[model samples]
Target: MQFQIENIPIQEVKLDFAKDVRLFVKREDLIHPFVSGNKFRKLTYNLAEANKEKQDTLLTFGGAYSNHIAAVAAAGKLHGFKTIGIIRGEELVRKVDSNPTLCFAVENGMQLKFVTRENYRKKTSEEFLTQLTEEFGRFYTVPEGGTNDLAVKGCAEIITENEKDFDTICCAVGTGGTISGICNGAYSHQQILGFPALKGDFLQKEISQYTSKENWQLMNDYHFGGYGKVSEELVTFINQFKQQTGIPLDPIYTGKMLFGIIDLIKNGHFAKQNRILAIHTGGLQGIEGMNQKLQRKGQKTII
Candidate 1:
């Protein structure tokens, strides 16, 4: 069989407490090795548009361990485009060898441009982009985390006829693009629950910009801390979850979403006999980078 990105199968999750409720996870992580899950969905249409524009280079922004950076790098290589990664944390330029994601991007022929976190915060500003255009010259730019109109268009395909039976849809929300797409594609009667990896109410506004649908809500308590933050308990849960379900989840997103779903189930968050579908938006490539940080802190490493 030929390898294709779409039509990923759903895996049923066995939860003792939620026996009355059906829990299924859309295996989006299996979409690709580097450009898996939401990254694949987010980049699909963006790449198409870039090609249509006859752009020879693709420039984007990300952090030291950003899955988007790695995905963009790989996509550039696979699709025959030069890639430039404007990375956050200028310190990462000196530490590229130690950061797995950056190393992967570099190896895939992505030109790494490091900037301070303060400078990276201006990535969307016209002034900052003008500077980038002056420096790099005429490149198609994908926003940090790959959330844009085209990206949203690609993500909206995540829910199709196969997923129509699920009463509620769930996914780990990062930039809100993936969930917004889900909201657009989901049935009008279905409820979409976003488990944010960061702590905040700000994502609601960001999501609202992409879709007018009011079928979704963000679950704010699941984020162990802000982005890239994880607790030992989360690490243990991720390891145990893999052992039990044979599904490897990245500590940053899918793992937290699953943990929250289970916790919510125990707390009676869902109605009896409700069907739930969770999107396993991949970030497994960043696990190595996360493990390095954990080891430096004398914490339990994710296996």
Candidate 2:
């Protein structure tokens, strides 16, 4: 029952920016083909805890194209546990074929349960969970976006002693677990900058509950519009980036994060001679779903 995930390598990207600045990407995406990047880190302990409790089922929440759902489903399949994904937007129930992530989850044997947006909100409520347990028979519940104490514990390992030379560590923030763990594990002298793919000042509060470190700051400007919202400019950047680096970035997280990092570097946001490391928290599984939307809109798709 080894999960088969491994430590990723750090790749230095030769960007056309200030020569004194060095940019590197910790390729967390290479950890696994399916349960890659931050998802792998976030689920490590949570899955182990479920096994310790003798729970056979893992229940979690996500949207139509949620990386969390896809990762959880894959992990369950790999580790021999039943998985249930409570997806937002009930309309997606009939459109699984059109959605790549959902389809993949179903293919991996994750039981899909579609809920209305209204009911999905109650997923965090005790009453709602009570009803779920009654129907599912004492399942292990993982919070939506998979940000919980165990998730934070797992993410803290993302930073290693070898990477301490970096002056600034950057990552894409989703539910905040990844960055929160990094914030806790990072050196006090290094600053942690999170480029959130979703729009909101609310993540600061959510992240604060996990770690007491003040070394992190969330950049609110990079989220194209909101969660799952992308622009032509972003698509173009993602395509060109892959061409330049041979690294594929997902529109939801890593792509937006790299865009913001390069922009900040070009604008002299970071002082000269700074060492920066960006975490490639993978969400590549959602590219097909995004491309489908782009095709329908007749816009450029991510390459």
Candidate 3:
């Protein structure tokens, strides 16, 4: 079966910023409520290949509040495939009812398997996969973060002829699949900037493995304390951004990327009259879970 995706729309962000810089966002988030943004793009061809291989099940890995886990569960349910999520943090097995992401995965008919963080670190190892295959019978494995060669191929489609005139493309990088694909699809004159959500020198190498393009660079300054970490300042920015632009940004990825982009623009990072396009790789599903955490810490929540 062919996986159908909507023609993502690019909307200009009308905000008070540098007068010479034009910023726009591609609404990849509007693709599907559950299987949205980069996840949908990453899964497009993978689902087709699974069907081609006659696979009846899809297995993947993620953490407690993983967007990939939720997306896979939704995709599997929609595509008529059984899904298994090998989740890190064994303690979360009992907290599934409270965790929005995991609860949604279960509600969508995904089987959840909780494992220690140590074992989760071995998710890509042959021994770990062999154990999983022996236990689960047969399943198509999607790497954690839903990034692979096919995922990159799907993400490359994000950059179309319409985006060719933009001077720079920006996106939140996780495992580097999205930006790598964007790099491959970008015009020679266009520069690609990736704002990683985590602190890592490893992503530079990870992205390189998928794309040989040299037009991309990673901005490491805006991680805001690493993966899954957020602050009151970021929450305020997100809330204000939504109120001003009518676009909701999850604190994990897109929010950080936008914060960095605007900061750069304010600091005179870009050349005058630069046209910047930011990819809104959706993880809005995670806002509820993040809000729950924020409430527990007496911190302000994402509105």
Which candidate leads the pack in lDDT? 3
Residues 30-137, candidate 1, lDDT per residue (tens digit)?
988888899989998999999999999999999888999999999999899999999989887789887889889999999999999999999999999999999989
Tell me the deviation in Å of residue 150 in model 2. Answer: 0.4
Error of 2 at 179 (Å): 0.5
Off by over 4 Å in 2: 1-7
Give the Å shift of residue 158 in candidate 2: 0.1
Q: lDDT tens digits, residues 116-135, model 3?
A: 99999999999999999999
Question: Which ranges in model 3 have alpha carbons more than 4 Å from their true place?
Answer: 1-6
The whole-model C-alpha lDDT of candidate 2 against the native structure comes to 0.92
TM-score of 2: 0.97
State model 1's lDDT: 0.92
- Who is ahead in lDDT, 2 or 3? 3
